[model samples]
Target chain A: MMWLFLVTDALLFAGFLGGYAFCRLASDKPWPDRTQVFDLTFITLMTFALITSSTTMASAVLAARNGRLQAARGFLLVTALIGLGFLGMQAVEWSHFIHAGARMDSNPWGVPGFSSYFFLITGFHGTHVLIGVVVLLLTTLRSLQRSNADELVEVVGLYWHFVDLVWVFVFGCYYLV
Target chain B: MSSQSGVSSYRTYWIGWLVLLILTVGMVFSGAKPVLVGGMLAKASIITLLYMHLMHERRRLVWTILLGIFLTSAVLVVLSVPDGMAM
Candidate 1:
């Protein structure tokens, strides 16, 4: 069930990225140099936070399956905190981008498509991260109250990892590629 | 399956994380388009297989998801981008 949901959601992103590619390629102007526009160090930190949280999420699922409820709770809490931090980092990145004159319709980079797609895609991914954090927190609270099925943790872990997976593409396409 | 312990499971996830980290960093430093896209795909595969536990799923499910997204995206790009490029 979750797998089906994730597959559909991934197709949604693929569509967005496809549109982005079309806009980028269709534009005659040169695209902004990614390195000049983005602070790679900060972006790397955001990626680290997300990837670490994913690891912690996987650990939580394993601990739950192993019948270590306390460990599961601990890991879930850690994962949620890291996810929250990643959101904050993303906010900072967005703020910086805006301050540098990037907007939905225009940017200092000359090619309007660059900033438009950057915000559109990353904004969509950030919303997913926000929802994942909220879900992680709820799962953590639920774990504290009762012994839930390990599958619950695994299901939530899948959602969290899927969010991370999307960011892997966003980061690659926007920041690196 | 039963023989694999919790510590080992944790180690596997961390190793996956480590590889993802390396690929991200490598892509950041390397300006080559092929390397960037290659690393991106590798990272995506690792996240899907290891982090998302797609590796344990049935083969049909795996192919469905992978091919569904790949083909759709490929069609989207291949059909649209050449016209854009020609403009």
Candidate 2:
């Protein structure tokens, strides 16, 4: 049942990834050098931050399952804060790219083929991160008040983890492709 | 079964995360082998396996992940509109 939807979603991303690959292959120009475009240190920290958020988010969910309200709230708060930091790092990364002239219209990769796809994929993932952050914040605050916190924690954990999943893809595609 | 299933999923998620964290560090130096391929495949596989139905224990996590894919596609379309149309 759940696997059904998961398959469909995988197919959808497959199509997108397929399209991106075809475009990269069809072009005469070489693909952008990832090591040059992305600051390794920033990306490394960014990945660490996001990975930590996933842990905090999951711990919060575990706490909720155990009926430990304060622990759950604390973990959720940490998750949200880490998520916020990821968003900030994303913003900073984007700005650095922009300042270096990595526009959606033109670039060292030629005609923004690389830039456009970079934005399309990473931007989409970043939006997910933003939404995940907000949801975690709200869920944590609600847990503090003792509402539908467990359900909310479950929901937000699903989302938090999903975003982490996307970053995994983005790391593969953007940096590797 | 339910408790085992739940704990198993938790354990699975954590293991996957640790692997991801390791791979993330591996990618930092732009490791020559292109870990992206293996890493992405590992990630997609983990979520699909562990979270097959663990969303709210309501339907399954897959549906929610799809909803996420749908929403993300909408966002991509929206972001691409101006450029897509101009092209």
lDDT of 2 by residue, A2-112 (tens): 234334645555456555655565566677777778887788788788877777777777777777889888988898889889989999989988888888768865746
DockQ (C-alpha based) per candidate is 0.64, 0.20
**Tens digits of lDDT, candidate 1, A1-177:** 888888889888988888888887888898788778888999999999998999999899888888888899899999999998998998999999999998999888789889888888998998998899898888888644655557778888889999999988888877876
> Could you tell me the lDDT of residue A46 within candidate 1?
94
- What is model 2's DockQ versus the real complex? 0.20
Clashing pairs in 2: none
Highest-scoring model, DockQ: 1
lDDT of 1 by residue, B4-38 (tens): 22244688989988998898888888868999889
Runs in model 1 lying further than 4 Å from the true structure: A143-147, B1-8
TM-scores of chain A, one for each prediction: 0.96, 0.88
DockQ of 1: 0.64
Best candidate, TM-score-wise? 1
